[model samples]
Target: MKTNKLILIFCLIFSVHSFAQPKMEEKKEQIRALKVGFITNELKLTADEATKFWPLYNAYDDKQFELRHQKMKAFKGRMEADLDKMSEKEAAALLAQMESNEDELYQIRKKFVTSLKGILPSVKIIKLKKAEDDFNKKLLEQYRNKGPRR
Candidate 1:
């Protein structure tokens, strides 16, 4: 029918237009893909496990990012404030903030680990933790070798 033909044309145009839009979301997707690559290799996930693991991992990562962003904002704000002048009060506040951020990060990690354990075997959970540590170590080394940020 003509109506069906028109509907198909509209759908095609919409799909094309969507794809034509800017790839602003691509950076997030690339980072996510890199994370999955790291996890998949480290965990040695089987196809069936991967199917379940990625979705859960993504959810866990999103929550971690939320917590981290909050801590980062607070830390950066304090550091900016301290640039003009430093005082014992400022130092104490920064120390407390840093400690709180560490605690929050630890708590977030614990929650993610618990959730992951519910979905994965103990060995896989251990692997995930090791992978995270290894990733952090490598990232730190890279930054150290690169010198100060521009």
Candidate 2:
């Protein structure tokens, strides 16, 4: 009987999550649109430059997404448990793994920058980085203004 109750609860959770997926996707699309608009206006991309720039930019974005997802999956269990209660060895190992992941992300950024060199001028590339930082800061401010989410 307890097992049956547990199964029912699991099913309910899954159904609720599935129902929320469409709205989650809509939010992602909205954010992507906002980001593109912000980048376009901030960078002052020429029509010809935009045409050549977007595909390469998308690849860089995808690499960031891939690296983030990889790190999340790799550290999935590490986040759920209380870190303060963990053994010294466990914490040390976690720190090592985190550092390694950060190094990998840094290398990925370096490679992406190298790939962007011939296609994009240094000024535009710097502008892109600045635009990204500004966009992120604005998003954070908006979220803060909205207060804590449930």
**C-alpha TM-score for every candidate:** 0.63, 0.75
Clashes of 2: 0
Please, what are the lDDT tens digits per residue for candidate 1 over residues 28-123?
A: 554354456566667777777777877877787887787788768878877877465878887888898889878987887788778777678999
Please count the clashing residue pairs in each candidate, in the order shown: 0, 0
Model 1 residue 74 lDDT score: 72
**What value of lDDT does candidate 1 attain over all alpha carbons?**
0.70
Candidate 1, run of 10 with poorest lDDT: 11-20
Q: How displaced is residue 58 in candidate 1, in Å? A: 1.4
| Top lDDT model | 2
**What TM-score does candidate 1 get on C-alpha atoms?**
0.63
Per-residue lDDT tens digits for candidate 2, residues 1-150, read: 343344445544554444345577665655665667677777777677778777887787887878788776878788679978999999889889888888988888888778778777899889989999998998788668866546
Cα RMSD for candidate 2?
Answer: 13.9
